[model samples]
Target chain A: MMDSPPGVADLLGVLAYAELTAFLRFAEDATRHAPSLTDRAALGGLAAAEYAHFQLLRDRISSLGVDPEEAMTPFAGPLDEWHAQTAPGDWLETLMKAYVGTGIALDFYREAATRVDDETRDLVEEVLADEGRSQFAVERVSVAIKEDPRQSGRLALWARRLVGEALSQGQHVALARPELATLLVPAGDDITRMFARLTEAHGRRMAALGLPSRP
Target chain B: MMDSPPGVADLLGVLAYAELTAFLRFAEDATRHAPSLTDRAALGGLAAAEYAHFQLLRDRISSLGVDPEEAMTPFAGPLDEWHAQTAPGDWLETLMKAYVGTGIALDFYREAATRVDDETRDLVEEVLADEGRSQFAVERVSVAIKEDPRQSGRLALWARRLVGEALSQGQHVALARPELATLLVPAGDDITRMFARLTEAHGRRMAALGLPSRP
Candidate 1:
């Protein structure tokens, strides 16, 4: 055993917990918004994908000789608080949150995966792969906003709040787990530069959703 | 092209919705009761399995040229009501609900799978195949009851109530969709006999959990 890296377990644990929580949140939103059985099934399918990702990360953590629970426990507070602070008010808001929030998180994971061991990096890249289900959210949200242009302002505000809260939690996690942060940014890399890239990507996703880039 | 069978869509719809709701309910229970990270991860994996089953059925429904939403509409009321009526109160109750409820639902789907076409039947059998995740429930519940034998009486009562409500919903489903019932039982096959077999299996499962068979 090469002693695993300083933040391998922590990163895996955080990602695993994130997927599990995303599964629950998506399941909840499906129940709340699935206007038809088809929509519900689609949302259910998306949630299942999240759970599958959670399993992969969890197994990877276990294989590293760390208790998956112990690994995930440290990140639960920040993740749960992020969800609490950014809870969606309705169906469209839920979709926006899932789309914007997932996009940013996956981007962060992709960036962080570059700094870890090949095995861990491969696992992270695999989990970060998009399943195209978010297309459903994008199409639906775009159509809904187009139909009622007035709703755009409110949804835009909601998306901004989601991004703000997510970034706050990301910073909180980075501060609480210095080793994990170091793994994410590496020894010579700039955390501030990485944050800028994440934010720029977030803005592009917002533009795709027809929402304004700034909060 | 031979038109789809009278009840094939209905049957697929019912199973599809059942899996979706089961996914949601399981996700909810996992959030509520998982005492440890491992337990929570186990529940998440189980929920993922249900969602996988949901996708299989939903895709089948689409292949038959019927809109999956319209196909799933008729059974939503009964399934939702069954869940509402049997909502779990705590961690133990949540585990009991997941174990007993999922066991019975799978049994019903298994029996009904017999009456459908080979392709559909195969899908049903595939989904019904146990991934051994329920073992997590059985072990936990059995150990808990063994530790505090006095709690057995109340938990047993809860199990009976679950069965009763499930049966009631089963009856409601049968009455509302005669085509579905006809497909489930076929000619000369006794529905009562099917119910007996289901209950017999349910009893065996209860016994496996150290609960009295009579309950």
Candidate 2:
């Protein structure tokens, strides 16, 4: 084997841990912030999907002769910190966070997919494939925004903060894992350009939910 | 079509709510109390299974021309109270709760399944089918007991408490929904006999974990 690229394990590890945390956060939001049993079950379904992705990534890490836990441990702190800083306070906020935060992370990973091995890229794309669950958040958030126009400003600010915290945490992870950073923003590619692409995509996502990209 | 059983909706409703709560509780326990990332993911997988069952029951309720949420609403208060009263304090307690509480509930539902309509009985069997996830709890709890013999007494007491609270809240549910009670104990059947069977099954489950049936 030609040494499976420098950061394949790192990328998989980070994504695995991210999916695990996403499962946890989404499950927590479903239990605590969902307005009804129907919504609770809906969010719970999304959480389950995140967990299925976590299992796939973890199994892939194990197949690569790495301890899945050992691979995931390094990113736990930064990701946990990201969730701690962006914990949603209520139902609508929870939906917004799910929509905005997940959108950005998936976009970042999709960008990194281009730099990874074909096998790893396929895995990344598989994990990132939208299963129409995000559309649940979009519909819920959009309907909420329409029902109360004043809420849009607050949700937009929340979305910005979510992206802000994600970026700050992303920088921390990049600094700590240079190889994984290289996977995201290859040797000579402008980091600024990658970020702009992420930001523009995030803007479109926010617009899809009828919210502004900026607070 | 012939009318469904008198309490079929009630049975499905309560069971649906139970599975939903199970998913939420398992996910919460995994995030908050699991001792390792592997265990966390294991519990997350179990949580996902419970959510799948919830979805099935919810869909069954809707298919029967009943509102899923409405069917589930009646049991929410008592079930929520059951969870609120029996919240686990740590990892072992969480495992014990998962093993013991779920064991008793499944047993009760199995007994009730004998009296339900053919289609409903099949659905009940499908939902109650042990997917081997409970073995995860059994192994973990067993290992913990073997590692620290002193912990068994506390866990045994916890198990008793779980059963007691479940029984109390179960009685509350039974009284509030007599038809469901009848479903579990048909006119000619003895409730004491049913309780004995459930208790016997719970004892075997506790024994499987090397824990005392009595505190």
Candidate 3:
């Protein structure tokens, strides 16, 4: 009978707060950038999904006999820093955050989930399931780039900055919680290789959005 | 058939946008004001409910064969103005907006619901139905005011300002779209009397919050 890993709670807490902040930032960005009521409504729907994921994570934290707030507090600084440093400036930038920023975060979480217990891994997978609005970002960004080819240079650069800030802050968060970091790699895996895999997936995502990779 | 009042779609559109903007404003206010993670998560849950209501109204507008954006365009200016003019300065003020401001808006909508077709009325009623978090606002506001009795003075003033701005913008919106105004009163109903009833309910709400009535 092995002791349960401390990483489970840390992972859930970080994920909970991420979903909560994502709800806030996405709703705010949609308010500022949605071009029409239809688009605004769509973004609002996505924000709702984030809130639901937040609740699921928070509830899991509580069921583990820990206060949800205490669990989530450790990662707050790093996540807030990432958002502040990568704050989007316009509609296209907002979509990039929604697509590229959130897309990568989900990618990393999915990768980490594989190293945790089955229950937590199932919860992470449920949260990561597509909410169906990612295509809205894809279509909107692609169309905007098509309309103004010059946007390609600016947006590609923006995506590059997002990746850098995200990875850097992600490292800070991982170091601040070693249990969580340990879960970033399974028993036999290397952390560097895990990061390389994340970066490669990010490049494929940028290519799919018709943007230049890695600056 | 009395030509099935043109105001139905207009009413749904306006409500849709209100819910959408409320979702954004509430999420932003939560980020700014919630004192703890639990409170923050609770407010985020409320914002999610608002977004869900927005979707319901938007879908109803679409089912009416109207473009949701075109239908919502007319009232955007007035609603945005009301929010900008009355932005909350702290957690208590935010709760006031959530409790008092939202209470007034729901009252007005419920009153207007009676004047529309049954289908639209039902949709309005459903959107207006309690999301169960209003009690959170009530308890938090009451506790704060109890701790610092002077807060009642400021909160009462804030609530009054919210009502004034809301009614002024409500009039502007009604004047801008006569069809919607027509829905404020069914045949043989008096608009003045309806407004008086709304004002009375607001007074009662203030009293419930332990604040002075109507300045």
Candidate 4:
């Protein structure tokens, strides 16, 4: 296959694991009743969609000719704790996780996708289309919060934590994949600007989602 | 608007509630990490996906002109208890829940889709596509188990509990949604056959996984 920088594989591995875990969790946890059968069905259906997207990532990894299992073996622990440590405090908080985390991850992946060749880039685009609903899911939660002013402040805080925890674990991910980040460096410049751009973009996402921009 | 027979809404409500609760619990519990950053990301991603699916269902309900909040209110309890009673012992057991329980739910949803209206039928079909990577995750753990014969029996027993707990919850769903079950009666058939078919399907799934078919 095509070649990229040293840690691009690690980035892909992390992305692949994210999709897999999300697929499993969505299938397992989305069982409770809603007011309507249609609502219930929709919930279950969306959960299933995530699973398919996850499979795409898995396929992408194996197609790259590296064993996904080996790539996924190393980064599993810290990522999991960040999630547990920042588990949603309630239903609304859960929605915020999707609204905030998936949205942010999508942004990051879009940037990472630009650094790769046609094959990997296409995989990234395919996932982007697949995640269309994820963005809508986030938007819907924002609408709900908008409808009820009481919900705004609470969800904002939740969104902030989602950002903070993400950035924290993200530090670990960066340290682990320095070469992946190196792909972002200009021909003669240092890597500082790459992260600065990522942070600036994250700030835009927060603003778009109606949260305050990070200092 | 098309209407479900008496109590069908309640049954659907319970199922929806269960979905929501399952989303919450799995999201919370799966994040319990054991030092692997890869594991952490995998688990977190899974939780985020579940939350997204939960939003889909919630939005679908609102689209139907029903308030999702009101619809989801009824299913928060008994379903919660069922999950509590059936909680997995560890990561492997958790994966088994994905394999055994979700595998069966997908089957039931597939069969049930035939009885619903076209829109609902399409939704079910869409959801079925999402079961994509779950089997692979489960398969990964299964491969690990067979590598060590001693691990087999533990997983085997775990499989039994997963199936058992599911059967118990499935009954609650069936009893609660007698309308849907009645709708499945072929307009003149014995209901027992329907239950038998469900059980039989569950049996095949278990056997396929090398987990003993339920007694």
Candidate 5:
């Protein structure tokens, strides 16, 4: 057997938890926040896609003969911790999280899947497609914000906190799931460089989305 | 311009409500009721599929130049009233709702679709196929009920109540949405026959699922 890197399952487990939580959050936010019919329907459609992704992950986990919910539980705490610690304060904050957070994660998964076998790679592709829709929706919402710069400032601050908390939690996950970390660690000199690369990618995303990059 | 039955939209609207409520309830119930990992994954999978069907209804309504959510609001009360009155008391009751309640609804859609043009007929088939997994899941859960006679009785009683409330609410829908009633009446002596036919179909389904059929 090819010696696989550590933390692949942990990575996927965390991804699965993300999908489930995103579904609940997306629905709750729409039902509680968005003021228009068009926004609500678009959000509902996005929420539906999240649920479908959750199902796909569950199916993949089940096919492994391990109950998905069990494989899912171990990663819930750190994942939930990350989200709570970085909870988006307003509707704009929430929208940014949906865009920036899921976007980077999709990029990470795309990069990581190349190291995996074909079957899991296919699963990664399926999830990435779902993530792409969510990213598109958040971009649309951001454009809806372009007429007001004040709204953009609040979201920019929220994005800063999100990235900060995400970095902290990502480290926690690396510590907690050594194998997943090992899988991602390039045959490298320093973990710091890997973190820097990720941050570099994040800055580019903010520039593209018309949000300012934080120091 | 092609002429069409008024109830076609009504029928689809009811289905939209069913999918929405089913997803919401299953999300709550599976998260709350099921103690095991297997049951959670199983229930969540069905819940995800419900949202997909919900989207199809949404798309179809949009194609008709109606916002699906707005179209859905009018039918929400009657539809939700039925589900509340017919609340599944246990796990098996939940399964029966998906199997018997939805099963009969799908059958009616199929039978009625045959009278319409091919596009409408294809829509019915698409929605029914979206339901295929839930039906299979209900059967899987039924196996466990068969092993426990105690579970079987509770589920049977629940199934009876579901059918009764469904009939009551089905009538409410027809009375409330007369144009909808006319579309499915098929120039028959009375729309009462549609109700009768639906009830008979539910009865056979309950029997097939090993649940008691009568009030």
Candidate 6:
């Protein structure tokens, strides 16, 4: 049996842990930060979706003869720290964080997905697919911005901080796990170019919510 | 369109809130108290399952011409209070709470399911059905007790407290919502008999985990 690439396992491990923490944080935020029972249910549904993705990545890691937990442990600290630093203070900030943070991470993973084996690429793409739930964040945030235009500046800054913390933590993870970094920035590709693409997509997302992309 | 019984919406509302809170608490406990990544993922999956049930109950309430949020709001306090009073202290306590607490709630819902309309009964049965995730708790708690038999007393006391708190909050809910109470205790049926059944099932669950059912 031909073994999968080592970097593939590392990539899957990082993604699995991301999904797991996303599940936990989203659920936590929904309970503590949601403005209403309706919004709470919506965010809880999003959390469940993240958990589903976590399960898929976990099974794939195990299939590769890797212990899922062992594969996930190395990335936990950076991910947990990112969450600690970007913890939202209210429902709007929670929505903004979910939108900005998930958008960037999914963009990074989608880029990395292109470098993996066909099966792994397909799995990554499936997990990263936007299920339209992010639309909830967009609609809610847009309405909030429309009602109070002054809030836009603060939310925009919040989005920028989210991306900043994510990138800072991303750098830490990349430095610590060169193999996973290689998965994202392939042999001939520029790391800055990959980040540029992520930033561009993030700009469009921020605009969609009627917020400035940069501080 | 034939409207469902007044009590049916109340019943569904209470259940929707319960499942929503279950999702929140399970996810919170898993993140804060899980001993290992594997256990965390297992509890996260259980939380997702509870969220799925919450969606079902929420949708049912909406279809009945009720606002899901309003329907869920009334039961929030009692359920939240129940959780506040029984917050687990450690990983073992967390597991015990999941196993014992969920067991009694499911038992109570199962009894109340019989008192609803046929369609509602089916939905209730489906939501309350054990998906075997509780076995994770049973196995983990049983092994922990075997490894250190002295821990059994503490865990048993914890389980008893979980039931006591659940019953107390449950009484608060029932008294506050007589329509919901009547759904659980029909005019001819004895409320004590229903409690007896729930207690019996709780004992069986406790025994299966190799812990004494009573303090």
Tens digits of per-residue lDDT for model 1 on B1-215? 15656789998998888888988888887887788878877877788888888889889998998888888889899999999998888878888888898899888888877777888888988887764667788788898998999978888889888888888888888888988888888689866677788888989988888887564
- Per candidate, native contacts kept equal 0.81, 0.68, 0.97, 0.05, 0.19, 0.86
Instruction: Please write out the lDDT profile of model 6 over residues A1-215, one tens digit for every residue.
Output: 05676578888888899999999999999999998988988888888999998999999999888999999999999999999999999999999888887788778777877788888888887876755767788788888988899999999999999988888888788889887777778688877777778889989988877677996
Error of 5 at B163 (Å): 3.1
Per-candidate clashes, comma-separated: 0, 0, 0, 40, 4, 0
lDDT of 3: 0.82
The model with the greatest DockQ is: 6
Residue pairs of candidate 3 with colliding backbone atoms = none
Candidate 4 global CA lDDT score: 0.61
lDDT digits (tens) for residues B10-39 of candidate 2: 989998999999888888888899888999
- For residues B1-215, could you state the per-residue lDDT of candidate 6 as single tens digits? 05576678878888889889999999999999998899999988888888888888888888888898888888889899989999888999998888887787688778877777877888888876765767788888988998999999988889888888887787788778887777788788866677777878888988887777897
Runs in model 3 lying further than 4 Å from the true structure: A1-3, B1-3
TM-score of 1: 0.95
Off by over 4 Å in 6: B1-3
Every model's DockQ: 0.79, 0.79, 0.86, 0.16, 0.25, 0.90
- Which is the winner by DockQ between candidate 2 and candidate 3? 3
Where is model 2 chain B poorest over a 10-residue stretch in terms of lDDT?
A: B127-136
DockQ for candidate 5, C-alpha atoms = 0.25
Q: What is the lDDT of residue A174 in candidate 4?
A: 69
1 or 4, greater by TM-score: 1
Candidates' C-alpha lDDT = 0.83, 0.85, 0.82, 0.61, 0.69, 0.85
Model 6 chain B lDDT-worst window of ten: B1-10
True lDDT of residue B66, candidate 5 = 67
Distance from true location, Cα of A97 in model 4, Å:
3.5
Give Cα distance to truth, residue B146, candidate 1, Å: 1.4
lDDT of 3 at B183: 73
Model 4 chain B worst lDDT run, 10 consecutive residues: B32-41
CA displacement after TM-score superposition, residue A170 of candidate 3 (Å): 0.9
What lDDT score is found at residue B95 in candidate 6? 87
